[model samples]
Target: MLEVGQSTWRHLTLAQRARLLGRLHATVSASAEEWADIAATSKELEPGHPLRGEEWLGGPYAVLTALEAYRTSVRALAQGESPLARVRTDAAPGGRLCARVFPLTAIDGLLLSGYSGEVWFEPGVTEAEARRNAGLGQLTPTTPAGVGVVLGAGNVSAIPVLDVLYELMASNRVVLLKVNPTQDALLPVFERALAPLIEPGFVRIVRGAGDVGAYLTTHRSISHVHITGATPTFDAIVWGPGANGERRRRANRPLLKKPITAELGGVSPIIIVPGEWSTADLRFHAEHVVTMRLQNSGHNCIAGQIVLLSADWPQREAFLDALRVAYEAAPRRSAWYPRSDEKLQGAASDYPDASWCADGTRALIEIGAGDDATALETTEYFAPILGVVSLPGTGQEFLDAAVAHANEKLTGTLGANLLIDPAAEAALGDGFERAIADLHYGAIAINSWTAFGFLIPTLTWGGFPGSTLQNVVSGMGVVHNALLLDRVERSLTRGPFRPLPRSVSALAGPGRFSVLPKPSWFVTSRTGATVSEGFTRFRMDGNWARLMGTLVQAFRA
Candidate 1:
């Protein structure tokens, strides 16, 4: 199949592929509810469970949103125009080009109120250079065609399918996707949703565990390999496993000659810049931090594992208390990903002084100056455990220490987050953006979770691209970059520090009044399931009525 498609690849126009994506949108829409339900059930979410919304947003809503994003880019590419022209792009400080991807249209503004994101081109990339290089595979209507193997991610419903989409549209390759065993139940739905690509020999879905992935990656027919798994899996694929593999790895010799890329899991951090705060500020940001840790039962690659707080801040202890309260009070869900029980137990052993739930399923640890944070510093727990570490400073001193801690100690460079009081950020002058620029992460979310970078299709969703076969920290390349952007560095997702009703208050960053309530992605949200269902419908057809209904649900959320 790949050979046939490779022969015909040059003539496969962007417009035709655009229609294929259109069909995918329809098929996925028709079965969107079933898709979400199956995923939710597979992940131990019972009917009517609050976290069912997680599946809705992660599965259908995420893919549907990607389809819409790709639609815009494909149409422009079909017309021989730059998709970057469709958005607001300009030069930012340090001579890098920044494309404001979110709030793209008026509809985007209305539906995604108070949220915005930008993809920044790497340092030294001029506006003209980035614009010229934006579309390589898409604009040329030509590509080096071959087969790519996609090793699906188990924790997130959207990741595997989205990676396949990136392969077809951006890399101009047909995909042989091996479903993650933990998410195997969604394979049939994936077949149906992806039938447009499947029928055309552009894609094929296979199911299996590590052995199958290894087989596919090494197959002579495969040209490139991509996976969203751990670093060990990458090592096994790159150098081959066992003592021989270790020797090969140490020697920087790779067994597989083919090019490979990955978005390996990381020990992500949330740097909280200290400032004067009111009771409302503490509560709102507490929920923000809790939502970051507990979402998807902490199975997210970008989950906030360790929090860096300022020790000298007067409200530091108060804020930590609020975090403990929120962490305990947040709605509990099953840690559904494979091996979660063992991982959580390891975390419990590492932080013996940490607070734990009665069921021993969740933990929150506070690292004092004298304590060892070895586990938190080095491991991607990927469980319902969050650590709080206080640095000895305030203002820029605190910011400097936190950024150094995250960049120096963390396991992966995939994602990092910063939660700052707007006033404190203002006081930092140019230092805030400087700190953001200094952080060595692929995606940086301000006052929001880095998972937003994953959900937003246009944003480059991978780690900073310097890792080699020798040191597989986060992987080599990025995916879901529908615009076909190049010279990429990172994505920034900025959101208002407060939600609506409260956002109008004096403490809600003064002038920033948001229509957004608590995000539907929040585990504590009441209307996420319904809001995301409506969002999927709206993305399917652009029905204003459906969007209006979704807005109602969001307001309720």
Candidate 2:
């Protein structure tokens, strides 16, 4: 790692930087082939059979999504219209966080509210005094381009490349990206896929461990630092470590302090309101919980950490049983990461009541408790363990109790979810609105998996105030959708109630069995392709003739 004294900023020439920037732009804009190769490589790194985790990361669906986003972005730029482009749900592009505004908004009678804080994209809208201290413009070199270093996350394959794209496209910065040790094997694939950028010096992949990361983070020549990982890692770089790290924090207080943005993890919670539901609803909700738990073996920060169920409501126990059955049936996942078993065991020790599915090879955990919102309920356990907590009372009472429970006990303020039915929402309209307002987290997703908001290019994902230049839980600020330049405390979201019953955490029953089948629907199938293509065509060409074309594609898939 290069110390402050050893770092050099003026080591590179102006002409070299310009050439590098040009190459990066051209390479990313070239063709869809590079993206396809990267996606395929990502599939190979799934730690297991391609069917389990590979399909989602770099599968056809993901490729299609990225390609569509790229097409839309270029088209919008060409038209000179800042129209929002629709990024298909399956394949999520990376650079959206650097855009002027989130392109995709709620359609289909569903509306998602952008954060209400004063918009900061334009000049002067920011508080003048605070703006002066932020040193925002200092990070943006007027010389057209400069060196950017990306500290990529190991768990996710696409993050490093995506971070590079965001910096290059959004900030007009050339980049030297460092792959985390965990992702070193995939380094060659990235280099090959991003050859155009690499050849031109616009982008280069340097592989190493923590030492390499520290070097890039503090390199004087590196103008910006974008990381997708632990908040502690980000903090250690910018502000040092521990409470005594105040010296570094103070030093960074008034200066540009290097433009650093991060997307950190959090203990995401799901609030299930009291509702009348059929057996299918129960099964579907159970499966939804299973999906969130089993996805990536629950390594995601947005993984459903806590389930706020209605304690007094009879459906709570039933839902638990359904979830248990679904989880037990889940295919055994390889113990991919270090300390995964230890972490799960630690959680089991803390919440002994929690259930575990260990058949010698793999472990799956579930928490079964009633109306207990303690530290165990709020903490983010990085293993496949789900805490089952409940709140007593009717729908309205449960809503109130649940919200209160989340705000008080949730470890990270990064995000939260509220699952409610249409009738309950209508009945408790004002109350529901008030509850949403009271939520202290950054992103609040309604009637859908919190991960959806993370996937959308239109949404900003992060945490609230307690996370500082030091300790960050929900991460320092938003990194996914770079719409706002200011600090965002929260993101409020709402979606269709039963769009996919099997994916809803509030339901308990046979619907739970359908979650696995849904993946085949999402990947390696024409269904997602047809529907996504139809939506894109309808939005672009506005052709009714293609509507049937879309449905037929889905049906055949």
Candidate 3:
């Protein structure tokens, strides 16, 4: 398989690559229903369950977006235009160049109003340098870099497929994708959806446990490796186990010599800037916070694990109360991922004083200050548990402390979220922007969940650019950067503190500000599957009627 892909990948023309991606997009769109069903069944979700929306967005919808982006790039290359020509660039703090990638079209702005995002280039990358590197591999389409082995993630259905696309589109390499055992049931669906690459021998999907993965990682045919998993898993793969692993890590000597890129799990934090918010604001953000944590049943690598609140903020108690209420009201999800129960039990045992909102299937734990060394603080629980900690100070002081804690004390550098009221943000002035510039996270989201950085195909998704194998915190290298820039430093995504009524804010209700409708992403919504499907179709076709139907279904949800 590797030999076939290696030979075939370099022979394809730019136009041919665009056509192939278009075909794959069509295949995935056609198989959207089956793909969602496969994911739902694997995770024990009922038919038409709201969580199925997750599978759709993460699977077919995500692939479709990536394909469109790649096709756009290749088509531009076939012409005499640079793919970066259409991008809007500006200077960011610390002498970084920021490019606005999403909302490329007016319709995108209409559909996702009150939301915009940008990718930040590495510091000292002048506008000229960024434009030069933006079209990295497309200039030499026939140059092949050999075969890559993608160790698929089990938690999200889309991860394996996305990793394969990145290896093919970004690196111009063929892929041998090893599907995680937990999601092996979706092999048929993947085979059907990604038939273009498989038929041409550019990609191969296999199933395996640790032994199979180890063999492939050490295999001679594989030139590169990418994995979406836990930090410990990456450690065990790159270094031997137990004492040897510790020794190798200490001595900066790795057992594996191949180039590896990974997107590992993190103890992501959401810093809540001290502010005076209305009742509606508190309620809306409570649900928003809950959604960030509970999405994917808290199995997501970018899930918000810690809520950093201000000890001096007068509204702290009210916000915590609202969070507890929202957490309890949200629907419980089955513990689907491996060792979920054990992880949750360990957290509970380590912090017996932590507040629990568990009802077997779903749980939320709130921990206090002195428990900093406990598992809840240092470990990625990978379960439906959120830890809340309050720190001293107000205004910029609190923001600085939170950012320092996230950078110095957190387990990973993958992603982080900042939730600040517009008023508070304005008052902080330059201090707010400085805090964003200082954050060590690869993806920094302002007033939105960091997961959006992962979802947006144009945004660079990986750890902060400078991680060594000896201390690979979030795993190095990036994926899903449609512009194809090789010197990407981080991705910064910003959204409104409270999205406009016709936008995302409609999803949260029970307040006067809510005017639009319920959002399909809500796990409590029964018609989420129908709504999400309609939205996916709309995204593919851009039909007004389909969009209307999707909105109607959202209202019903």
Candidate 4:
């Protein structure tokens, strides 16, 4: 779709460049004011309001907060001021460490810290050189006014927005971001927050279903495409074969010649070793494994599908049973999107006796099978279905079997998770760490869910492209934490041996009622607003009393 003709890549004069940069900044800043107004209006049309459900709320504070944080961080780096030393350089292969800050909870306010070294992968750079490279991120790249089309996914609220941010901020490309019909309502929020870009022909939005997406992807004026959706969707765009659409598929090559980057779904796995676990530890991890299966009603790309069990160990049965019980008690969320129940039922029919968390409205079907372990573990169902598989030993045999099973069976190379106890780690030593390296995945999580890796701003997210483009799951390139240059396909993961009692993380068990709403309220609403505001103010004003107040409120939460 991108036609790089002779007229492309025009350069602006120095004066013109200065004017454009100032205008861009001013435009984005003024747009924030519009977003604030939208937020105020949306607040008035609350739950009891007639238009509440019909009109999606435009609470642009989150977007505004993100913009402010980005501006602050970039400005600071440009001015040679970094607090956390996240940017560092040395005379090694991966010499510089570059940290990118992405605030997950903007309800509190977005704050950027870190990014302290040479972000580039310079081979023989000193610490001073590394710092200088990081400072370059502060310098804004200029755009030549070409249209970039974005094929957005419906799952994450931030993916599309951030994709646009990447093209705009990093690539300096003008964008036309198309929203998935499933999340059509969020378009208004984007319009409000990115008003300046929208007004200046720098950004635009086109909303519809598959047809709209197809058009945009193949559009003549579109220079580039970025997608956050299913692998099937990407295939359709590049190769084309949906609903008897054979013309493009037969072509064998892509119709649109423009470069495309996609972050597709994956069938993520989580392996559990049955080594030295008390009943409590077993239960805690059981919940952890299942929580990954249940997050976002089990529609997530990184949700755990294959449960790698230590076959020879006795604790495997106990953990499985605990997981079943947890599922029985866990709330059955509304499938959330269409065709969810059909997929759930299809998965259940294969193994009828699989455990189900049902409450008339919805159900999470758990598939347990000892025979044909590989068969059930191959695909991502995009619904709440867990396939249990077992390996037959501990130590080297256990690790070997788990890794072998995953490699032999799983349909994805995007990500994997391993829950290893400290004692197990000590026993295996180098073998354990080597197994982690050997686990063929783009991202791996040790002792926790793999989703955290994607959520954390410090880590990169993407999978190997493999031989052909069609088979790739997670995707070829990485986006988050762009400061790192020579990243070996990111392993953004987290783990904590001892459990935190009140974390809303997937591992914790909250009986009958969900703790997330409470936690969200604690962080987002007026009760927490004062403290949050105080913390932000402290960065600029530095009042000790205000700082204490902020700390006290955070502690209470």
Best by lDDT: 1
What lDDT is reached at residue 225 by model 1?
A: 95
Model 4 residue 222 lDDT? Answer: 79
TM-score of each: 0.97, 0.71, 0.95, 0.72
lDDT agreement of model 2 with the native: 0.55
For model 1, residues 401-500, the per-residue Cα lDDT tens digits are: 9999999988899999988766787899888788888888999999878887788888889998688889989888898887788889889998877778
lDDT tens digits by residue: candidate 4, 1-557: 12231122123332342344344444444453333333224334222322221111112222333344445444454445642245332232233332323322332222211101112222244455434444222243333536778887675555676667556544556778898776675567677556655654567887998888888888788777888877777777777766543455555556557778777766777888667777767766776776677655666788788777776787766887887776665444455656787877776666666555655332343444444444456656788777777667888788978888776678777778888766677788778766765677766777656665654433456674352454555665655443323333345444454343423233443111112211111111223333434443453344677766665554453
Q: How many residue pairs collide in each prediction?
A: 0, 16, 0, 6
Cα lDDT tens digits, model 3, 169-269, are: 88888999999998888898899999999998999989989999999999999999899998888988888778999899898888888999999878999
The residue pairs in collision within model 4 are: 86-116, 87-116, 87-117, 88-117, 118-130, 311-391
For candidate 4, give the lDDT of residue 288.
72
- In order of TM-score, best first, we have 1, 3, 4, 2
The residue pairs found clashing in candidate 1 are none
Ten residues in sequence with the least summed lDDT for candidate 3: 509-518
Q: How displaced is residue 356 in candidate 3, in Å?
A: 2.4
Candidate 1 clash total? 0
